[model samples]
Structure formats: C-alpha cells, structure tokens
Target: MTTSPLAASTVTADMVWIPGGTYLMGADDQYPEEAPAHPVTVPGFWIDRHPVTNRDFDDFVRATGYRTLAERTPERGAPGAAAALHVPGSAVFVAPDPSAGAHLDDLSRWWRYVPGADWRHPGGPGSSAAAIPDHPVVHLAWADVAAFAMLTGKHVPTEAEWEFAARGGLDGATYAWGEEFTADGVHLANTWQGEFPVENTAADGFVGTSPVGVFPPNGHGLYDMIGNVWEWTADWYAGHEPPRGCCAVRDPRGGHQAGSRDAAHPEDPVPRKVLKGGSHLCAPNYCRRYRPAARMPHAVDTSTSNLGFRCVVRPGHPAEGDRAATG
Candidate 1:
C-alpha cells in the first residue's frame, strides 16, 4: 500500500513484486465453484503496479476527507435503486454500432445506470477527471477498500491477498499469464473479444475501462488483476467453503462464504457481498465470471460503476513493516 503518488501520470511508481510460489488455487474446469483444483503457498507480496487511479482516488478523497459510498448514501432500492437495480452506478457502456448488429443481453440496452455517478462522476454528471485521469478507480466498496487500507498504511488484499496477487507467479494458469487464450492471435487479457453478448470487436483497443497499465505485466508484476473494474477483497461472501474451508491465512484474508441470497438463485432471496476482479462487463460469451476461481456475490447494500478497490500492507504494519511478513 505505498501507492500514494497520485495525480495519475500513468500512476506508476512501480512496485509489483509478487514472487511467492505454489499455485493451483481453484477452478480449472468451467466453474463447479472451481472444483478440485487446490494447492497453496503464497509468500512474497507487494502489488499495485497499476489500478487505483482516478488521481489515486482523488488523492484519497483529498487526503482523507473521504466520501465515496457513492458520496455517502443513496442506493437503497428503488427510485434509482442504486443507479437502477442492484446498482451499476456511473455506468455508460453504450458501444453498440458495429453496423448496429449488437448484443449483451440488454446490458440495460447498453449499460446506462448513471446517477451523478461515482469515482467523482466517471461517466455521469457530464463526466470529469478532466479526461480519464488515467481511469481505473471506479466506485469502490468492500469497506471502501478497508478504508483505503487504513488510510494508506495499507490493508485489503485477502482472498488470499486477491489470490496471491492473481497468481502472477503462475502455477495452474487459466490466465494470470499462461494457458494461451491467444498468443499468436494477440488478445492477452481484457476479455470480451466478440459475440459474448453479440459484438465487441473493439478488439482490446478500448470499449471502456482500460487505462490502468495498458496490459502485459503478470508473473507477479500485477496490473489490472483480470480485466478492469471489480477489485475489492478482504473477503466475506462465503459459499461452498472448502480447501481447508478457510479461516487463518493471516493479514486481512477474513472471509469464507455464507452470504447466499441465491448462491446461483437458490430461489433468489436477495443476498450480497463478494466481488473480485472481473469487470468492464466481462464477456466470454456470457459473463466468464472473471476467473481467480470466479465470484460475484454483491450486496453489502450495493453500489456500482463496476465496483473498485485496492490496497494492503499488513506484513508487519507501521510504515508497512519493512514490507510486511512478521506474524
């Protein structure tokens, strides 16, 4: 969580270590809740080589005067129910004119949701940041990324610190860099290439959200984690708990699933809270769930613009304990 030099000059003060080994965390065969694929390890840390922009959350809401929860509170169901149903605030996709042959199962016909939007009105209220202040800093949650990682001392990386910084030191690669979704074809990772909802041939040049670090930086140099928006972790959405069923990894990793409003519509009761990397409306022809064992619970009252967050520094605390790892 040293990431403070904000004002987005492409926000790269550079850190991205991520050495840590032993992977194969979960899901190798199209989601049965990422069955069987286990194994762990994780040690070395230090991430955020990118992501957490919008002038570094507007200098962390102007040096901790902070407000974002969509500027306090409003999204509580109906009358703009958090920017239209379960929230998707500041939304503004619309990119549909590949000769008008579009699709994406009515992503609200093209995303919309807007309500004075957040991340300082990303695509709403006449959008500002003066010109994409290097994007990536949407409407954060997950306790406002643990209160901006305790106001920059750092803390918020847990889901095993976001799957050990998205398994960037690769192991059972589905993509954190490996197992080829395309190499000679060149479409490394930004997802939704085309026909996922109908037509997205922007071909990774841009459709929305893609300014974090442009792309290419995993093997632990973490950048964009897995597609743009959808960061937030420090865990807590519990469902189908296993693999030592969780609890005790140390440092912010506190979650193990249990907030099932529908756990895949187990009859839709309306639960929420659980959102990891996988945004820019991920479209592997139908919400590829944004791997890292794919998850999406969402409901800690709700708020969106694709969701956002990033921060962590608990290796030993105070001044980041010489880069954390102290027990």
Candidate 2:
C-alpha cells in the first residue's frame, strides 16, 4: 500500500492526503439508489480539504479565462429551449411561500431558472461573491467542473474515491461524522433545520452555503464532505449494479454515459453524472440526503445553487506538480 503524506507541505494546504483503503460504499437502509451496500477499495490520493470556494474558482477563471456552461446561452433546440427560460441561466433555490402550501414532491415549487445566475452572481443579478468569497461556488455544470479540473491539472474523483474519502475511515457509519444527524442538538454540518422549501431556522448560522471549514471535519480531516453543497463526481449517474456474487469491487468507477440519460425526461437526452453529499436544502421533512452514502444524479448541462465541486490528485500523478507550477 502507498504511504500517506506525513507533512502538509508535501501537498498543497488546500488539499489533504487521503490514505487508500477498503470500505463499505453504500447504504441499504437509506435511499433505494444506495441499496445493497458493498465493499470498494480506492487508492491513496489528495483531495481538496473542502468544497471549491468562489474565490478559488475566481482565481482559476482569472488565470484561464474559462467560462462556466451556465454563462452560455442555450441553443434553439436545446431541452430547456422555452423562450422564457432559454436565455443563459441557472437553477437557483427559491424558498416557496409557506402560505401557498407547496408540496415537497414537486421540486418546481422551490427551484427557479433564474437568468444571470452563475458562479459570480449566485442569487441572480444583484448577488455577488464579494462578501462570501469563501462560500462554495455553486451553479456549475459538469462541463464547467471538467474545465476547472483541466486548468488545475486535477481530475474529478470517481464515485468510489469520493465515498471512501467522505466516509473518513468510518466504514458503514450513517454519516461522515457519526450515526446521529446532530449530536445533542449541535449541528455538525450545514443542513436545513426547519420545514423544507418553506421555513429555515438557520440554527446552523447559515440559510444557504456556509464558509468552508465552518463545521467540524470528518475523521480523515476532510470538511464539508456531507453537507454545504453537493459535489460532482466523475462517475456517470447509473443505478448501482454490483456483481451478483462478487466479494468486493476494487476501484469501481460507475456506469456508462448512455445509461445515465434522464429517464424522467428521455426526450431531452442529456447525460447525467453522479453527485455526492447533500446540500443545505436537505431536511428531514424533505430531501433527507445529508449523508455520506447518499447520491444524486444531475444532468451534465444542468447547474444549481446547491451544486459545486472539489478535485482530486492521485499519488505519483503529475497533476500536483502541474498545479503547483501554474500557481
């Protein structure tokens, strides 16, 4: 087995060295998508200590002149080509009016396709990243994240790698930290504390994204692995289909792109990738996905207020040196 880095200087301060190991990858008691929990092994690698912040992404943009997919206008025949929503935009979370009696089943009650909402303007036109520079940068499509990875000479972590690191060596635990969602009323991560899409108690001192490292880190010293914002993974969003009788899967990636197309909107045909962790919008009454084993599928072209990403660098890979030189 590869040795873990002993000194922080060996890797960038923004990243932490994750010692490779085998761990239980999914949960059988939670969402159906995470059924049949199985064993998965991943190699040692360096991962961002927290989600990528607006300031971090801004630096990358300034250095590479890269534009996020959300900043570009959709083609005439694109899936979301409705004249009203066809303009360059992203999906932002807008809490529904509680008096309206919005139902949790209908996502449209809280999500809006807001024009001019991108990484720079998280909440539409007037919003800016000036004050919350350390907040995780949201509204990023898969292609946008790929662009960031290319510039930094890093790569998105595979589904197995992401789960392994998020678990923080606590195999089969209900959360990244522990079994309890909150320990003795103390919130461990940023998640909805009140009714979903209606009320937010802000008990955790955040209604939306919180500054990175605001919460306690996991056992592996990784922060924001369970909540803050959903993180992108390299694996395509296909149902987990483990080998029927296999003992364990080694470095399992994911499904094919063709298989990851949105079944609900088959006509649109845009492929989706796996998104790990939950977001501040996750709540007990609503999306109960604030766990390391939880996973979601998002269209490659879709971006949202609660979605962002971090990158990984495998040991012995040149990406770390390349990133250092670029800086």
Best by lDDT: 2
- Report the C-alpha displacement of residue 293, candidate 1, in angstroms: 1.8
TM-scores of the candidates in the order shown: 0.33, 0.91
Score candidate 2 by TM-score against the native: 0.91
* Alpha-carbon lDDT, every model: 0.61, 0.83
lDDT by residue (114-179, candidate 2, tens digit) is 998889999999999877999999999887887677557677888888999998888999999888
Residue 42, candidate 2: how far off, in angstroms? 0.8
Q: Name the best candidate (by TM-score).
A: 2
Clashes of each: 17, 0
